[model samples]
Target: MARFRSICNTLEVLFFLIFSAWSLGNRGSEAKDTLLAGEKLRDGENLVSAHKLFEVKFINLENSQNRYLAILYLFGYDGRAVWIANRDNPLMDSSGVLSINRKGNLVLTSGKGNSTIINSEEPAMGGNTSATILDSGNLILRDGERILWQSSDYLSDYTLYLQNDTTLGTETTREKGRQLLDFGHSAKRKLWLQITVLVLIIMSAFLIAFIICRLKSRYCDSGGNNEKNEENDTASSRLQLNKFSDIEAAYKNNNASEQKLCGNKDSELPLFSFSSIESATNNFSTTNKLGEGGFGPVYKGKLVGGQEIAVKRLSKMSRQGLEQFKNEFTLICKLQHRNLVRLLGCCIEGDELILIYEYMPNKGLDSFLFDPMKRALLDWRTRVSIIEGIAQGLLYLHKYSRLKIIHRDLKTSNVLLDCDMNPKISDFGTARVFGQNESQANTSRIIGTFGYMSPEYAMDGLFSEKSDVFSFGVMMLEIVSGRKNNGFYQTDSDLNLLGYAWDLRNQEKILELMDSTLVDSCSTNEFEFIRYVHVGFLCVQQSAADRPTMSEVVSMLSNETTSLPSPKQPAFTIGKSNIGVESSLSTGQESVNDVTISVMNGR
Candidate 1:
């Protein structure tokens, strides 16, 4: 009896300690350094580094109620945000949540289902994944023990940084919801509130059903079928039957005509209604149409908020419509650059596939560069600036961007000019992302403007950064001489732009090729004009190995003193101007921008 009493006392003490630890954990004192797969980091929860110097959590930037997942300084009261995950996309309200999906992808999803950001790379071990914050100030996404990705790689150009702890608790989330519910001017807030209430009610229903299941397992073991039990079981089954049959879910699927937009689950694109866009584009009226391109008609629009936007509507009859739309939307949405055109959002209602972009007041470069009267406006200084800007933008795409991309269909029309004549690269439907070590990729479908395509890409479908450089070279020549390369009919030596430029460079009379409009103004400094012509030749070299990388191109263009390598004889494959031109031309379209679909060569 004495020994048993002693054992009982020890057991009680052990139980007391365990209970205290659990209580402390519940009170937010649990210092967890890792989040396992299938688990979640709630709006206010945090993951701290092992050394506690760095922490990551969703913080409301400046208490603006716009929450972002950011790295924060753990030990300091003074706030500092060094790196942000969703900087481009902030959680609108408290409904934002971060979790590891079943596929082991890191996902940040907002409450109202508006925006969903997913980081999907290598597959985690069947959801047996983990996210850890290390002393090295790295947030690692892991699959079991395998390291899938690291935040350090994403922010290599940036130094380590963080902010003060500002995690939202459950109560805080509720309070945020309440504030938005009562204070928000938009009806969307009320809908968000409804979503929150529905979530809570769903959870409650799940708990009740679980309890009922447990009771049935225990009480119905003897196969007893009493009246009350039968009625209860019948009612429980009925509830289960009705659980998935919500009116909203049914309506969502049935509303085909409304086409209430929802961005693809993987993409972080915003949904825009068909009606709103119709209003913005003035009912897609003929007068509002900006111009037609290979994709479709582009319309200038003004949103209800007084923001101007350019809308690209894909042709309904185009064969490559869906694939091109997905490619442009998914790829361009991820890339951000001053030289890159920004996609505001897209509207996909029924048969209409439309993309909205930040409106460029001056329209495409071709509008000014090729026109005899407008060409006078582009002085030597402006042309040089445009060339440098294009080079820098291509450099970003090739080296600086998170993914190395090749802009396959690069030309004058795809380059839009802003209010200040700043060039922004657009029309990325044919752009392809390359692996870190990949030098080039092959495609059976030769889809790009004919004259601008490099010989290698034009003949063999081999494309890389060099192919874009080749295109840039052709455009540079056109900008200087005010000539169009598409079906370029030359009476002199039967040479295309590349061949003609090559011939001029060999004779050292590049000044002859300069635009006639700028002859008197630019004659004082034939040196600058000749140097640009020299750089253009280097870019259009026959071999991809001969063409300088965009970074080197920028350096050469910037520093006139930099000695340039003599360019080799280019391929000059357009033996007859119309030979390859016809093969690359879109069906039933003579003008470059008229066709809404690219000619595809079957594999």
Candidate 2:
């Protein structure tokens, strides 16, 4: 009876082993969870089912000497890595063991007692801690479903900023929202030991299989063929990576973007929580939005204490949004001038890149100067003051500031007006700074609005302080005539606003160039105002050398006693070229001239 019982026990054990192996082999990979580490963990394998937004893997830190245990983010991004676990004490080899220990501790142990314990104070025996994967690419640890720790809440890498609801410009709290996990002295040797153990396990399994194969040669041949097939699949995957143009696409297809690359903190900017910005914007209410730009929409938000701010949120479709955010933040933080718009702060939580600015009651200058009815409100004196203010601002950009900045795309729309109607140069999105004595730069990908761009910048991509002066010149003419540079018309001539102004100036019919609205409201001397037009013409000269520097322009505008030099012909006359969208001057009726004035590359 004892011999029979022993035989039955041996049969039962063999059957159980066979069943487990069969279940593992035939269960299909669809049930795999990303965060789980064990037999499911394979080299270059993406677990899609566990967490669609993250991946499990090892990666080299960006420009670092060591690698780390991390989870890579796979969401609305250009394949950014976030949330590192065991950042400081990473396993040296692929064989390192990561698993929940018997005591409910998230333990990482190598050979010879080398170990790391991510402890939960109230850990419930073996089932105390449960690992959950979040949409934010975070793996959380819970004690009986209560979160004890989370990867997202602790940011050790600069790329992994936690999303929370915090106001822009205010100092953020560390514990209140999230804290950066530091890479300090911890259990690293034990992790290395576990890697060795893993290798031994794999070797032992292969050795056992080899002995079995000797006994059953035919069955072993089939297993050897299956291994060859796995190798072929792996080779095919490597070939796919070479076929893709960029790293982003390759990672997405394989669902490998969630792998964390680094554990270093290199970013200097403070993290703003998503909840704060969301609550402030009233959940991105349409009513709070002021307008839209190349980046995204602008929202008018009021903080906790009723502090009003204008927030520029970069849209997901904005291809250059990240570059713009980094550029604007780095540039705006160092710059300070009364004529320039003040950057309150920026929010870069998740895909959102938000810029907060002081609210301007009068909004942008373009809104007033371009609108016919609104233009009438600005008399000759107000217009002249605005032009002078703009000149001062430009002068600061060209010479007075710590860094030499070129306002590559200066236009009336970018100029904001305060409550007192003072012009403040805004929107440094397209602005570029040059080293001392560096005069001009060129880019194949040209950017900036039409009509305001200088001939040199518009055609050949050459830009300098003179380019800004040329834009200022165009704006000057618009202010003086109360018309848009691209959409000006007279019954007699087909010339654009600038062309007509040039024609009138050429014929010495300077009085005709004055805005009729200014004529009715202002008691200021007409001759003095026409002198402002003369200065405008000088600044708008086709040649950069002929156009005055901001300092010279400021001097010319400020000194009423100084007689200005004769102005040259501006670029792009009606007979020379058909430029931007042509628009009609008539109200309630659209004509050929009403077409939006477009400017082409000049002679």
Candidate 3:
């Protein structure tokens, strides 16, 4: 008896310690918090987590406004949010408080003494409810044994980013009152009309039912059974049909439309909801804003399934109108080359037109090439590779793609970097497509970056394949020498990067113009790099006819046997042009506006 009493006492103490630890964890005192910038809720108080990694509090969300509660994580990392004593009634101010009641049932009461039951083991005298977060990321509330509401069944824009293998399953179609029927056939030598008229009546009924369903389907919306009739539903459906008809009519009206922009009506396109994008971006928080441009502000967003995407939201106030936007959207969808930026998809929701793209982690080339410390990462080998990559991409866009495209705007800021340090030419807002037979085209409105723009295009709006070549040449020089073509040499000389390169090439001191970051890594291959510089100078010639074709440029870069011709002095007297034109196109246009973006924690 004495030995048994000692063993029982030891067991009781162990149970007590376990209960104590669990109680402490339930209070949410131990979990670490990453208080991000822009999550300003209260003055000092914010979300608190349980050390057990089970619960997160600060209960205010899109629907849970001005409410706070203690929740449990039934699974490892999932938050139950089971105990919201104030469900129907919420506090107007921050006066609402939640605490463990005397019975260990978490309770919440309003300042007006109105308490709403969140979860209870037993149903109220007249009502029934029980709430729990399941391991599959499903928050469920039950009335008796049957579920009254569940998070798994009802989907919203935002979802908790809990760490779990919980996956959204494939969606199934819902039908109204449809059942299977078995067919019976009777074989008799004599004409066997069923003696029982009831069975014949049932067969006739099925035929009538099938005919009615077929009739209903003919008039119904063609986008499956997703159609629901509301006040504006009819008008919206008409508009969609009208849009489709217009596309068809456009093809019929313009015989050349097939060759024109945005002609591929058969291409499979991705469709995403506006609400989904808004939720993914946390309603476009200021933190996720990446960069801004003339077209719109670009934002960083993560999808619910953890796919990172960049969204470009076009501003309504911008000089470019809907037509320009359409042209850009159309050109990008059809133009696919290894060197060109890939267009993943686009979203057109009301006035909110957004283009979704594969997120480039390293951002634009300007970010690193211009930064003092970051530039160190771009060694000679990397720089050389980048130059080669850009060249390859341009070659594809110029010669390999279905249509010959002239990228009117090919500046350092538009060159995007992939994960492997590969370069991709992006931003097709100013691109123009030309046929193989068509040589030159002129536009009254001259639109291009000032420093990168060829002299002929800048003055008389004469642009062809050569305009992009000029920009590429200027960019090559900028890459070789860590200096902006337009901004460098502002003091005594009006000479730009082209003029400087011309002078250096003439004096045979071209090696001095190389970026210092390349000096150590390029110790052995300096000669090859010098030859590339000489090639770059040759491409940026004064006349369009004098400039080498992209194909010729590639051949010169690859062939060691091909002797390169000496380049003439480039035209550098652009300061005398209209000062207003220079200021408007150079400073005003290049300086894109800023935008605010949202970043959700634990994405």
lDDT of 3 by residue, 427-505 (tens): 8877888865677888766666667877677766788988888888888888877787766663555566777777777
Candidate 1: misplaced stretches above 4 Å?
1-191, 196-268, 573-597
Alpha carbon lDDT of each predicted model? 0.69, 0.62, 0.59
TM-score for all models, in order of appearance = 0.60, 0.53, 0.55
Per residue, candidate 1 scores C-alpha lDDT tens digits across 285-330 of 9999998755678899999999999998887665455556666766
lDDT string for model 2 (482-576, tens) is 77876555557767777888888778898888878877655457877788888888878888889888888888877888878887888655622
**374 Cα displacement, candidate 3 (Å):** 1.0
Give the per-residue Cα lDDT of candidate 2 at 317: 66
Question: Model 1: which residue pairs collide?
Answer: 44-168, 72-162, 72-163, 73-162, 73-163, 80-162, 294-596
Error of 2 at 351 (Å): 1.7
Candidate 2 off by > 4 Å: 1-271, 579-603
Evaluated against the true structure, the overall lDDT of model 3 is 0.59
Best by lDDT: 1
TM-score ranking, high to low: 1, 3, 2
